[model samples]
Target: MSEAATRRGTTSIAPPDLLASLDPLLREWLPRQRWFAGKGRPVTGFALISATELLEPPLASPGVIHLLVQAEQHHQPIHVAGTPGHSSAPHADDCYQLLIGVRKALPPHLAPALIGHVTHGPLAGQTVYEGLHDPGIAELLLERLRLPGRLGELRFGRDTRVDIPFGLVPRALGAEQSNTSLVYGDTFILKLFRRVVPGVNPDLELPRALARQGCGRVPAPVAWFESHQPGAAAEPLVLGVLQPYLKGSADGWELALRMLAEGADFSGEARALGRATAEVHLALSRALPTATLGHTQVEQIAKGMTERLEAAAQAVPALRPYAPGLRSAFDALAQLGAEGRIWTAQRVHGDLHLGQCLRAPSGDWSIIDFEGEPARPLGERRMPQPTVRDVAGMLRSFDYAARSHQPWAPEWADTCRAAYCRGYAEASGSDPRTEPVILRAYETDKAVYEVLYEARHRPDWLPVPLAAVRRLAAPDPARDPGSGR
Candidate 1:
């Protein structure tokens, strides 16, 4: 550990003026980043919470810096409470884990990741870019994980039971939203959590548990690293995780859209995906502690759903018209709780969707990204929740994919939803449809979340969730009987 990587009193050592020099570059670059949670608001300033020089310059041409920078901004109210894009703590600055590479000059291929030239501070006249995009820096990260050890406050560890091969080429993946991923020789992929909070992230926790349970439905973690601040918090902040990459595996969203374009039936794939989801859920339940949500817990869940709807309605005028009807979903859920109903809860993939699943060439499905809603608190995400929450998210995803087609294919989405439910029922011994009230409430909550998200981020896509909002708020008994129709 270098002097700057050490802690003095309670503060992590930050090189003098390093953050000051990078301030302008980050302010301009952060908001435009896909993983940036504080979008729509300008970054006022940044405070360096921690900085670790993984490879110091003068010794290395392109040195790597691991930084936990807290960005100060005028954060908006949580868009839809507890949703993915919204920040967990609304009143505080957002902390980001950034792996930056400092180079005197950049090559052509690495130009896109450049933050800009630093004209002041320790890195004056050096070019800084996303470190993970640099193959050499990415390899250094893998080396750290390969040998379980500590670099300053950062610790790296791997599954000793598994051997990670060396000399794998690294390449950054472009499709991720809340994190950055780099593929290593088609054998391993490392996910660097962009927006971080202190605690063991579920992305690493759930998958490791599943691996021990011998559940292959989700890829097992290979190696990982985290920031361990002794005085800051009880738990360390999980920075990045390396897991086995499913080579030639097709993304479920892309596959769904392709099938839709070809006018092919996707119910089979949807059904298989459902079975895979249930398997993971079952493994999680068995691997982790399970609980029953009594009247109080149930009431809290309903209250949260209702509160989210109200918040979303306030932010989105369109949601106001349907707010009254939407409240009924949560109200009904609360009524059941008041009447002494109880539901089983357990650790679940809080943000499950088609996009999170991958179909291997052998037709098997594997789920990924157990980080839950990226912006939620790690502890809240790690808590037990009704498994139906995951089911509702996947159902919403099918609808999203269907809407992406030229002409909206409600039937296609409907068919996939039904097939998925049937498949889950077959595997889990409990159909999500059987819990009509819970399912409807969770699904409604998810739709309300989407409405606010799309309205805020992609205004053009707002109609997708608005359509669901219309259908969900209204009751057509002939078509569906679940919504008190």
Candidate 2:
């Protein structure tokens, strides 16, 4: 976390000598927070694009914090855009982020609380917007929503391109760990990289590869945006990108929950999802095909997680209970590695939980979100550990949904689990008997990672994954929980 990672409206008594006035500035700043998104720290590193300072009144305007352009090396710059809040003080520092081609600003009520400052590079149009309040914002905000950074520029390969249609009203679709998504209309969604990892976004990179194999289920890319130049200090930064949106598509987890809710009879649905996923795997194999899973990668998965779990235990002692046992599991994995696993690494989904899968109303199951675990490094998420790793991610989702609404008994989760396993096996064409050992190992590895994640984030949910670790660490049941097949 950087020093400037948090900046709620509050100011330090010895606030920095920035140009903006203290009172009005702080008052307007507080409400712009993303609850799960990190908030509350003195903003230290800042560059400006344009400033639509509201020197007047009534919920000061600009309507929404739609977009801005001045430059942190801004792409499209807009200089002054706000409705002007009432203020008696004289303003001096006139620098502003340039919001390019500002046709309109949003209605007042719908404006988001926090808006961008300045942007630089490869952009054309611009707008400024405030944060969105759940119940509703003023009308100005609703009218003014900025299109995400340069959707026009995203290029997946030398030939393929993505196009985003305007006026789609792509509202914010809660973010995954790594990316913040906004779904526009019923057609497309834009995933803005939050902590951009280097190379190309796996979400953008691998999907293109899968698409090349002509996979039907994965949302085909319409466009992609990336920083022309990688920042020396920034390994992960959102340049921007867009994808064909699956309006009625349900993620694998949500789908599982629905099946569980409907009495755990996802035979048809699960089988379809399974078939679609298997076909995807096959398509991936054809695209950036690989031959074998390396021992190093497997050991790394286990070893890496064990280290993280150990580190987490240091911070949260409650996590200590599972550490020793987990280490034993990792030790066991060390003996086997990801040895002789028939599947090889191509570009696999880094994180393959139910949340990652989208089920369209048409009954076609499409997978999305190439960016792996948001917390892990880009390289880590992009790496191919084991095919079962992805399978385990889905299985984990099944457990989550089963017990999603019911935490204590988790009876429902069992049903979802059974459906998921059945689905995976049929789809992947694996024999149930063969996959369990490997799946259990992968599950253990995944649980360890989850343990660390929960311990660090939702301490209350720590048990959600910790409990998984305990299960994974237990004796290997006859069925390979790893292979959904």
Candidate 3:
């Protein structure tokens, strides 16, 4: 087919017949993917949002297809005695981006990326595998980004100030959770968001803002691509971002684990990490709109936290007994709001942690992955939040690392937490420790979130957050002097 014919084809570049044959394979293959969100529930069906042919027969050896598909799954209905308990809609739809590569025969090296044989599709008897694993597909994607233009519904763009080098070797990084990354010639790493939504993702939005502010703690994006919906009013969904890859850098997670193994102190590194975080926060505050949470907003924040706790308690029976104790943390915030105490809020790294940071050999810390919590709505992730939320996340990370160590090192976590707060205070001029009420509330909220997440995803790790739940529930007078013990 000619390029014009392909453009004029049906909205779904992959024909309906092809989708029908591909559905069963996806239902089987998707759940196994680490990036797939609908793991526990059964995939009822898949709806193709859009598809584009990046490469096909005659032009390329193996065809490459880019797809935006939604996976629908049903949640268990709640039963109540008073009413006939019928939920409005039992199913939920999660949109995902997939790059599928099709070939005639399976290659030994690419066997791991195989989805399975399509019994009846446009190309029946064609072998399909993940596109990122195919060098040809990766090269083609980079080429598209190199030249800014629109291809079908997808738009490719790059930072004009920086010239992107061509013919760079590509290799996908395997350690990511909800996204896949391809490192090109050890110079640029392109992150492909697997689970996609219909707005500008923070991973792309915040970096551009920080870059404009001349922030050195975060890497700026050099190239990116997004797909526009057919409707005029629909927003473009970001598909991927290409940024400079930091060579000879180690992530904070591995560094922390190694330090723990060597029975070394991590307080110095934690303090530096804290300072790095404060720098990023300062830059973001300067670059973005900042707000002061009024009494009404404070009350709403407390109410939201309380609501999350209630929902978590209902879902996980283990959280039921400690619900009252947990409620106190949020209630303290509400009480502070009642007293007319206000706090500053700004754009922050919504989901900050050890793994989100990298340390160069020179011992400089660089924060990465501003996508925030993957489970959160796009609007919520982009909203200006109290910086303490990020501080709480890092503190919890230290606790998590300590717990992962043999025999559990609570003292180490405590020392590191204090050091981190001190470093933040030194850099930001405001100490999180002084704002005990709000800090405790955010920490408690983070712990509740962790509990629910661990219970649902990693049952073995449930004990880690439960330990925090127990401690936060019964705030020690000595450890948490301002927790209203």
Please say which candidate is ahead in lDDT: 1 or 2. Answer: 1
Each prediction's RMSD to truth:
4.2, 11.9, 4.1
> TM-score of each candidate?
0.92, 0.68, 0.92
Worst 10 contiguous positions by lDDT, candidate 2: 1-10
Clashing pairs in 1: none
**How would you encode candidate 1's per-residue C-alpha lDDT over 1-485 as one tens digit per residue?**
32232221122324658899899999988878898977656789998878888777535578778889999987554453333333333435889999889898999999989998999877888899988888888887777777777777888889898888878888999977888999989999999988898777899999999999999998999899898886854679899999999999999999999999999999999889889989998998899999999899999999999999987787778778999888888888999999999998999999998888999999999999898987567778989999999999998899899899988888889899988988898899888888878888898999999987787668888889888888778753233412211
Report the C-alpha lDDT of model 3 over 1-485, residue by residue, as the tens digit: 23343332133334577678889999999989999876657889988888887776324567888889999888755332222322222236889999999888778999999998888867578878888998878988887887677887898888989987767999989988899999999999999999999998999999999999999999999999999989999999999999999999998989998999999998999889889999999999999999999899999999999999998777677777889999999998999998999999999999999999999999999999999998888999999999999999998899999999998888888888888887898889987888878888899999999987776667788889988898888855345522211
Indicate the worst ten consecutive residues by lDDT in candidate 1. 4-13
Off by over 4 Å in 1: 1-14, 75-91, 476-485
Model 3 scores a C-alpha lDDT of 0.85
Considering every candidate listed, which one attains the maximal lDDT? 3
Quote model 1's TM-score. 0.92
- Give one clash count per candidate, in the order shown: 0, 89, 0
Between candidates 2 and 3, the one scoring higher on TM-score is 3
